[model samples]
Target: ALAVGVAAAALLGFAVALTVTGLDGPEARRAAAPPGPAAAGAASRPAGAPDTDPDGAGTLREGDSGPAVSELQQRLLRVPDVYRDGATDGHYDAVLRAAVARFQLWYGIRGDESGVYGDDTRRDLESRTVR
Candidate 1:
């Protein structure tokens, strides 16, 4: 329990530092690399449904299943404010929606950030992924 808390705190601290210091710096990109196929400066879309969203991240929403949701949760967890354990269960539940809202608010991607996981949200969220 202690280890988990410590790790979470450290990650959150690092996240805050990155946000405050500006991710435009190369060091921030290497430090927060998200799991994906893309390389540096490239889009990290998880590769799923068609590119309906302007950001082309995807168009998943609540009740959706599979790897995309899992990926989204994993990225949300990195934000630190999501703060929900077991987020990568591959279920688009309420917990995920709330987290998505937080992410949307953080990135200013409004419209339907209510766990809808639409293209706009996906685009903003996907940009955070470390491919």
Candidate 2:
């Protein structure tokens, strides 16, 4: 019984060490890469749905107000922890900007600035959510 227990412990330790080493591999590094221009082009949208940002500007920043901003807020709410306040009043305020930044950071999207909503952020969010 003692020898069996020791062998099991050694096996568990070896497995943990292997996992720790694997975390430094290329795939792990890519998965953990920070949001930036380099990460922006990593994902490609599949065919079928038209691109979300048709106008191509995809610029939604603070102080803007209207249905579009409201829609953006609604979408952000769909992402867990991205927009916790759940306010969709069509106003682009600090809260909304922070939520957008959080979403970008979480998803490794960096085509636009931290708080600004640009094509990359729009595409990534749209890809992850339903209409």
Candidate 3:
């Protein structure tokens, strides 16, 4: 009888420990926020909805200049308090690179000043914009 009671107590203690530890774990918290209104709206809108660019990138058809370049330009534009020397012509010159580096710093992208705003940089840019 004593052994039976001890075993049951041990099981109860294990269950309580699991519940308490899991409650405070990292996965318990909700996500920070949904994606930007534009992107979220785009998905909900009808397929034929007007030419609104969902990603918050400016409206421009594919194959014009290049989607990658145009999207980068838009991301740069979205940076708050961003002061560009001139326009975002997709040139990726020193001026644009500097702007991107500043953006990287602001957005918490480590080592983003490599003069190449690749996939990681793009993801960081998008996440910041969405939030």
Candidate 4:
């Protein structure tokens, strides 16, 4: 009888371990991504937060949104006197477009009229940002 009880307990433990492990599948993980600061508090930050480049985020344009945008906004805000109204909202808006243009003009890059944060712009920003 004691042997049978131990076997049952072992089976129960195995089943539980399998259940927990199964919950970490891609679908389950995708279903559990929100409610953190990425979707909560940080989504609403003003235009003055310090940031790091989370991902390359493709090429940020007038409608893109991501941590890279946040970092760009922070870098622009570093020149407070120049970008007094820049926003760190993780979105590429009109204010960010203007700021990017100003940044491009300040760095003297020619022939870019759309104000898009492309590779050259990103490279210049990375080189010129003062921490």
Candidate 5:
């Protein structure tokens, strides 16, 4: 009787092990990028936050002008490493928030969505750009 009980316990343990092992899938293992500060909180930051470029030195190129997003910027919206969601239509909305989060995550900066791309974010973007 005791032997039968031990065998049943072993079988149960093996089944459980198999079940747990089988649960590993692409969805389960999606390598989520590190999270940034909450978007809502970051957006309303005080005027004089710790900024990289307070003087507005980094001007957007021809396509980067206006609230309208550029193609390159749109491409950035798709990069998983960049952490944006949905389309990059140049409006500084949630997608841009995610992009800023990605930028902050990559550069190890404290996330603050001041809407102005600071020197650190710009520098990191410049360094990572593929010519």
Candidate 6:
């Protein structure tokens, strides 16, 4: 059983190496990197200005929830037939994602990913909605 034990040890060592190196690839590394100056600037709003951008990171997608999601729902409701259910429940569910995608299609908001409430979508929605 010495041969089997050696093979198991080798497998364990390979697994440890993989874990140490991380298998998530370059995208994970880039995401883990600290934000640059431009990203930092975009994350901060001017003093005394309204916090119109949801979540402050300027992006929201499915599975997010909070006041920001509620605000997004309200804004989407402002546009006719965009958020028909009109539930402002603070949860970014499938309905909200579909609404966001519909709004992006109707308004030509191609800068952000479809079904995502990114900076471009937020700017356009805020500009169109009442303060």
TM-score leader = 6
**Count: clashes, candidate 6:** 0
Candidate 4 ranges with C-alpha deviation above 4 Å: 1-57, 111-113
Worst 10 residues of 2 by lDDT: 47-56
Candidate 4 residue 125 Cα shift, in angstroms, is 1.1
In order, what is each prediction's RMSD in angstroms? 21.0, 15.8, 15.6, 12.8, 16.3, 12.4
CA lDDT of each prediction against the hidden true structure: 0.73, 0.81, 0.60, 0.74, 0.54, 0.85
**Ranking 1 against 2 by lDDT, winner:** 2
What are the models' TM-scores? 0.51, 0.56, 0.42, 0.51, 0.39, 0.58
User: Candidate 2 residues 23-122, lDDT tens each?
Assistant: 6568655545567863454446454644554325657889989998998999988888899976899999999989998998889986688888888888
| Cα lDDT of model 3 by residue, 17-47, tens digit | 6577775445433222346877787889899
Candidate 6 global TM-score: 0.58
Residue 39 accuracy (lDDT) in model 5: 52
Q: Give the local distance difference test score of model 1.
A: 0.73
TM accuracy, model 1: 0.51
Model 4 residue 48 lDDT?
79
Candidate 1 lDDT by residue in tens digits, 82-129: 535746888887778778877777778876646578877766666877
Better of 2 and 3 by lDDT: 2
Residue 96's lDDT within candidate 4 is 85
What stretches of model 2 exceed 4 Å from their correct place?
1-56
Window of ten residues with lowest summed lDDT in model 6: 49-58
Candidates 5 and 6 compared: the better one by lDDT is 6
